[model samples]
Target: MNKTTLRRRTFLQGIASTALTAASYARVRGANDRLVMALVGSGRRGREVMSAFLKTERIELRAICDVYDVQRGRAKEAFKLAPTEIVALEETLQRKDIDAVLIATPDHLHLAHTLATLKAGKHVYLEKPSSHKFEEGSKLIAAVKQSGKVCQTGTQQRSGAHYRRAKEEYFDKGKLGQVIFARAVWHDFPWQRRKIAPQPKPAGLDWERFLGDAPKVAYDWIRYDSWRYFPDYGGGLLADILTHWADVAQWMMNETRPLNAVATGGIYHLNDGRVNYDTVNAILQYQNWNLTFESSVLPIRNERPGVLFQGTEGTLEITRADYVFTPYKGEPTVVKAEGNLEVAHATSFLDAIKNGTKPSADIETGIAACNPVHLAKAAYWHKKRMRFDETATKMLSD
Candidate 1:
């Protein structure tokens, strides 16, 4: 490793040790001492995470911030928070009582929000795809290490019992002998087959704030509500949905980043005038195995939203709900998953905060999961195979 990376690793190690000691001390406290958390960006995913966090008895939602009045109003109605509690991001961060901030903002704003939250001396539960660009993820890693705060990425599958068991029993135990090919797929039809006419920006919506750091554009509700379709706002299907399965593939294969990437797909069906592609098939090569990921907005739901591992002995298919294992010579086995994964992941974040431990999906793990995502996008844009540096810390131009 380079000197800078070595130094950062050493620094993070020291912080982890100190946090572990602090967690032990914190454990002695009473159960009444709950952690205060605030939600920034009360969008769909934000509300989902908040709902999961609400299931955790150890956390109390003290504040909710959003650029849209509708989302803030909905959050207030659901959580029964006072009008004063639904405020702006700056005001939410200023509150000293908030122990942690759950950030579910758009892709373009993730870096800015995360950095501001860290600077405000609050732990962060950042959603997936750590940064808008590949290089920005490194800055986040450094910031997390320097702050020494519990930062959990939203790859909740890491905390799922099924994923843990699969990783431990099948992959780690060498049961999935010589895993050669891993395929991840996420297919859904969340949009209309026809084109959508642009609507006026809704009242009480801060369009400028929502478009912070993104390229300035005329206010359009289609872009605002379904921001994932735009390049400036989101990373299309790859970043939005593929991130989950890519993370799982990386975790199962015990890989941080891919060796190279080549992609070929486009907006073949959904012609909604969206800047980003609707259908994308990307192939990422790793040292030991290869991962092929395909995502689209097609209505066909064949083998929808799951990861498949092909090994010498057998093939294992894993989803958030359960896993199916099939051996070459034996009958296929199915394992049903128990408990709520979202709640478990939220609890892991709270535990990490109270105990000064790293959450199952820590900052580094988030960065690792994002590697192939950013690379695939790059490959699609450049129309050329892309590779990461030897250290897998930086993306190569070629």
Candidate 2:
């Protein structure tokens, strides 16, 4: 067999073995009734996801994993978990009792942790902006497909009430006919970036483990606390909020990848020693339409953050909770969102696990959402337009 085929076969065999092992453990522990879950990386986003999972009584949070003792202790106290439950990921994934894991680690660690979780025979709920680099997404997608697991991405908008309605009632219905252009904007005032001096590493902190697969760097409080500002840990605002809007655009348009991308912006306000830009304006060109995305932490306009779809007959404005339809000649109509998206998203994962189905934001969907953000970053860094391959699987240089 060819090398690629041989590798794939071996990977599938490993997954089968893991599944059989987990199945035996599940039968012994009555896991068919309720799924046992573990939370990896108990930071801000980790706690937020924990809250959402708690809203549903279907799954039990059995363990917490983190490199730092502080986050592990915090999660343990908040969740009434045992000290034994607060352990390393290597230990948590070894627990066959865990039917699934919620991976809220940094972007750089996502690919490794996700691969390990899938290999360990557990379902994964990974946060968005799935990888630190663009190339890592393909590996993640391949692993998820081979493992035959229910892996969900944390693009919660796909499960939101208004967002669903907008796609079904407006976009899919063609009420906004012949959509040619779209604009998405996120303008807000973030807290000022401050210089944090380096301090001694905390006890029980596995610094090297936190830097897995990332370039070696001395531990700094600023980099650790504000990881989004550095490329090693995060992809800045592009990977932060831009990925959400890009996903929404792709979902609304029923498209995955764009044909070309260009971006322009800089760290206009935050003079702090951050590597990412604070202001960004990017455009993604598709075969049938174009999507323009802009994000600025400096603009203090009266308008809140939203996305606008301009079609031939009308325009639809959408936010996290609501959507407004403004026809060319008729009065505008608005729909307020109903239900909690976080709960819905979490519930969907559990349902998918039980039904052996795919969640709304699966691995492919996550990669589709994250692809444009990576392209935008490339365009910004290179100061040139970038072209996406015909298959939309790889980004090509200009």
Candidate 3:
């Protein structure tokens, strides 16, 4: 067998051998049963997700986990949580009372955190770009399957009512005929490029824990505060912002895997000691169609954050607020988004657990959506066209 296949088999074998016992699995909850949930990471995104979970009925916040005391304090203050509720991830996972975990950790910690949560026999609501590296996607899928838990990925658009309606009306019914080209864009605002001043590491902040498996280095406030722009912790704008729109494009097109990808970008504007690029443009080649994604933190004219699908018959554009379709010869039709996306997504996760149904953005769906972004990054880094081997779940050498 090839090296990639061998590696995949070995990883799967390891997961199977270490699978949790039957008794360790989380018990099924009834329709009205209260779900005892914990929040991991407890950062800005974590707090936002926690707020959404609070809006859902019958969800009890049992614990909160974070490495930084300041972040923990912020979560406690925003949620009215008790000081005792703050716990380390290791201790929190050991609690039998906790039924599920909402993990909004950094990209690098996603695979490790989600795998540990699944191994602990708890359901997970993992944030987007599920894996830091492409190979970790299969590991996550295998662990979730072994644990048989409802693991939802935080691509909230998948659970949105308007998104579903637009899919059903336009792409699903052939209203947009034979879509050939698609574009996803997410340009950053000026505030996103704010300068970070170097400061001493805060007291009681576990910098090592925050670093996770990343290489050890002197504490830099920029990397700690804006980890998304760093290559070690995150995939920059592509993984942070483009993944959501790419997932939507893949979902609407019913094409999950991309055959190959070509990407180009650089840190032209925001020279803030970040390794990741500030401007990026990538094109993913599928079986029959192509999808492109572009983003830059620098100022650009008429910049909008959304996805556009162009077909033979018409064109459609969708964003967080709304979706509009304009036929070749008819007036454009617009549909405004309704309800809270995060709240709806949280509710869907709860419903999936209680009903034994797959969440809108399950583990497999999450990985599939992320794979293309990973491929694009590979192409960008290598400066060559990169192809993906779906069976072995690895990027092929040029």
Report, for all candidates in order, the number of backbone clashes. 1, 0, 0
- Which digits, one per residue and each the tens of the lDDT, describe model 2 over residues 338-397? 888888899889889989888988988888899889999889899999987877667787
lDDT of 1 by residue, 1-398 (tens): 99999999999999999999888777755344878889998887888888888888787787888898888888878776663545467888898988999999999999999999999999999998777788888899999999989899999999999889888888998887899999988887565344667767778898999999888888888888888888897888788777888899888887876889998898887776777887899999988799998878877676537999999999999998899989888899888789998899999998888787879999989887887899999999889998988787666767
What's the C-alpha lDDT at position 183 in model 1? 91
Residue 249 Cα positional deviation in candidate 1, in Å, after optimal superposition = 1.2
Candidate 2 C-alpha error for residue 288, in Å? 3.3
| Candidate 1 global lDDT | 0.86
Q: Per-candidate TM vs. native? A: 0.89, 0.88, 0.89
**Cα lDDT for residue 92, candidate 3:** 89
Candidate 1 residue pairs that clash: 23-355
Candidate 3 lDDT tens digits, 1-398? 99999999999987876665332443334322788898998998999998999877568887878888888889989998773455468898999989999999899999888988999999999999898899898899999999999999999999999899999999999898889999888885565588988899888688888898899998888888988778899998789877898899999999888889999999897888889998999999887889998988877864457899999999999988899999998999999999999999999999999899989999999998889889999999999999976574679856
RMSD of each: 13.6, 13.5, 15.6
> Worst lDDT window (10 residues) for model 2?
189-198
Better of 2 and 3 by TM-score: 3
Off by over 4 Å in 1: 1-32, 83-87, 191-196, 391-393
State the TM-score for model 1. Answer: 0.89
**Distance from true location, Cα of 316 in model 2, Å:** 0.4
Give candidate 3's TM-score: 0.89
After superposing candidate 2, which stretches have Cα over 4 Å from the reference?
A: 1-32, 80-87, 189-195
Per-residue error at 110 for model 3, in Å?
A: 0.8
